[model samples]
Target: MYGFTIVENLQKIDQDIKRQELKYHQKRVMVSKEFSFDAAHHLHCYEGKCKNLHGHTYKVIFGISGFVDDIGLVIDFGEIKKIWKEQIEIHLDHRYLNDTLPNMNTTAENMVVWIYEKMEESLESDQKDCRVEFVKLYETPTSFAEARREWMTHE
Candidate 1:
């Protein structure tokens, strides 16, 4: 009877250790930052003509994904937003997108990639663990563009 009880307690301790390990690896988290800017652009060429200058109140959404750290947070959302505001919105807002971005053609697709690149640079400079997973740029109420880093090849 004494030996059986000792074995049962050892098994329980093993199970508890397994549970803790599972909990540690099972942590997945995502954090996002949102920013907006108003920018004007004209497509250089079009059949029906979006050639005329126009502007949109553009909305940009950035997503960062990773396993939560021991602190149980992927990253501080406020810090991400501040980076976006400084690096993107402050520069692009009330400006011509084509003129503001060097070598960028200012289409929604190009703008999305540009935003992604800027966020990537800023995140790296800040020494942040989270990466710029994806960028979504809303050009209009019904139209948008999305770009992902080459590393985000899964989606």
Candidate 2:
């Protein structure tokens, strides 16, 4: 009985090691990160509560789909934060969205598209293997808007 248990445990450990090795060699991965910012904006030519100036502690989620390099990562999360903060947050955080993006109507739908564009601009590589996959923005606790690269491409 003791010999049988030892063999079973060895087999399990070997199987687990093989799984980890396979994961390390995985070529493609989906990486995502979430961030939040506070900003105020008012919709133009709209008939609703959003038309009046207001603020929201907005939440944003970014997704990247890419081929993992030798480091076994699509991109570092810290790098993502730095890119977002420099490219987008500096202009939007604690500022009026209307003034920052004058052409945009300051709606969540519009803002998400703008964010996606900024992310694309920040990336150094144009390789198709890695790219911005999606953006999810929450204007309110229950209400949100999202854009996906596949959806945008069709449009």
Candidate 3:
């Protein structure tokens, strides 16, 4: 069995490690973040129960890729959260999907693409060489729709 051990000494910058050693490699990497929100929506011209207004605790996952910066960071989790909160989630969380989102059917498939685009748009303005790799929007725990970078770029 593994035993817990307390840290004895914290490495000091410039003494134990140099600033040049902060970045470990020069390779592209991907980071992911997931967030959840609750919203109500009704599908248009649908032939199912979803035609009526219903609510779901939706989940969204983002995959972003880029070359790491000097500090071995591709993008900080907090920065991703900030982008989600400020640019994307504002139009999503707790808002009526049919009204808040751009005119669409409000389906997970559509939403995922919208999310990918929004993140890409934000990254273009804020991050250097960072791009959205994929976005998965979950309408239910077992159901989701995904948008990928290749798919987006080709079309």
Candidate 4:
């Protein structure tokens, strides 16, 4: 009976250690990437300088959150770029925003939301434990907008 009790306690201790390791590995981490594009846009109803068609060296930062995988990376940098190339870069880079996203105004606020949604769709099929966390858009060097998945809704 003494030997059996000792074995049981050791097994319990081992299980607890494994559980803690799993929990540590499963904790969320965030990774962000930045991209640049040149695009032109004009705000339709704006009463400011944005009303006229103008070009900007736009900057975008994308954030993703998830558990670190066996490779110890939240997500690969190249993978993020590939996703952007497919989901956003190809259409928006060097294109007129009004012509590219005709359904909506090309304000930074609206564009940020659109980027988040597009990235979300592209990441939906990911087999990893990751999701889009946030998107920041810079229409100018200092002027920008941001969106987070928790604050925006999909229809």
> Which has the greatest TM-score?
3
95-124 per-residue lDDT for model 2 (tens digits): 999999849799999999998888877874
Global lDDT for candidate 2?
A: 0.83
- Name the candidate, 1 or 2, with the larger lDDT value: 2
> Clashes in candidate 1: how many?
0
Question: For residues 14-115, what per-residue lDDT tens digits would candidate 3 score against the true structure?
Answer: 899998899999999999999999999999999999999999999999999999999899999999999999999999899899999999999999999999
- What's the residue-level lDDT of 80 in candidate 2? 87
**Cα lDDT of all candidates, in order?**
0.76, 0.83, 0.95, 0.85
lDDT of 3 at 63: 94
lDDT of 4 at 49: 93
Q: In angstroms, what RMSD does candidate 4 have relative to the true structure?
A: 10.5
By lDDT, the better pick of 1 and 3 is 3
Candidate 3: residue 144 lDDT (0-100):
97
For all predicted structures, in order, the TM-scores are 0.74, 0.80, 0.97, 0.80
User: Residue 13 CA error for candidate 4 (Å)?
Assistant: 28
Off by over 4 Å in 3: none
**Model 1 lDDT per residue over 52-145, tens place:** 8888999888987766665456777887878877887877989987777877567898878877888888877874466877899998878999
Candidate 3 residue 129 C-alpha distance from true site, Å: 1.2
Global Cα lDDT for candidate 4 = 0.85
